[model samples]
Target: MSARLATGALVNALVRRAGSAGGFATVLAKGDATAGAVLIVAQDRGENPRLLERGIGPTGDVELIAVGPDGDAQAIADYWSRRRRNDPDLWVVELDIAQAERFAAETMLGD
Candidate 1:
């Protein structure tokens, strides 16, 4: 299995990458330093909010699971808030970028 990144390192890297690309990112809630699950909120061009999580595809490649749009921002936030309650070790990383899918395709790592 591929090595997983520490939560802090992962957050730092993501923030740096996003800034360099002219997009902005920030952590909504911090989680365990060593083994937190990353739940990304990909916001594209001020519309179409999506919930993203990393997972392995059938082909063994790293895949970003996009949980389609959950209508408005408030609705998605509420959805995630409920989820966060269940998994306290979840990291909420929001990305405001032009193309969220491209960001996922570029960053997610897999074996």
Candidate 2:
């Protein structure tokens, strides 16, 4: 599958995982013909955040990642690194659907 498709699939998996956390997951997707796309997930304090990582905000935290038909892994990493450097706490996760599935399964194990 194409990178865009892969990314989209990963984002969908994340949304699903988030939703399973008792309505504590929120996703924001935006795109333009030229600008490409991005997926953002806000996960509130719940088993989900604890599953992913503890110490996240109770109100939730933002997970931003680029999506769609442009940019390679390095580009995506650099883009976020350059712009989001001010927010040093940002976590960068690169995954496909299979990886996401494994992540979900592992997280469900409660570390």
Among the numbered candidates, top lDDT falls to 1
lDDT agreement with native, every candidate: 0.78, 0.36
Each candidate's TM vs. the true structure? Answer: 0.86, 0.28
Candidate 1 clash pair list: none
What is the C-alpha lDDT profile of model 1 across 1-111, one tens digit per residue?
567778778777887888999998889887777878778888876677888887777788768777635547987788778878998988888888988767755775522
In model 2, which runs have C-alpha deviations exceeding 4 angstroms? Answer: 1-5, 32-111
lDDT of 2 by residue, 22-44 (tens): 43333322223222333232223
Query: What lDDT is reached at residue 79 by model 2?
Result: 56
Residue 51 C-alpha lDDT in model 2: 17
TM-score of 1: 0.86
Of the candidates shown, which would achieve the greatest TM-score relative to the real structure? 1
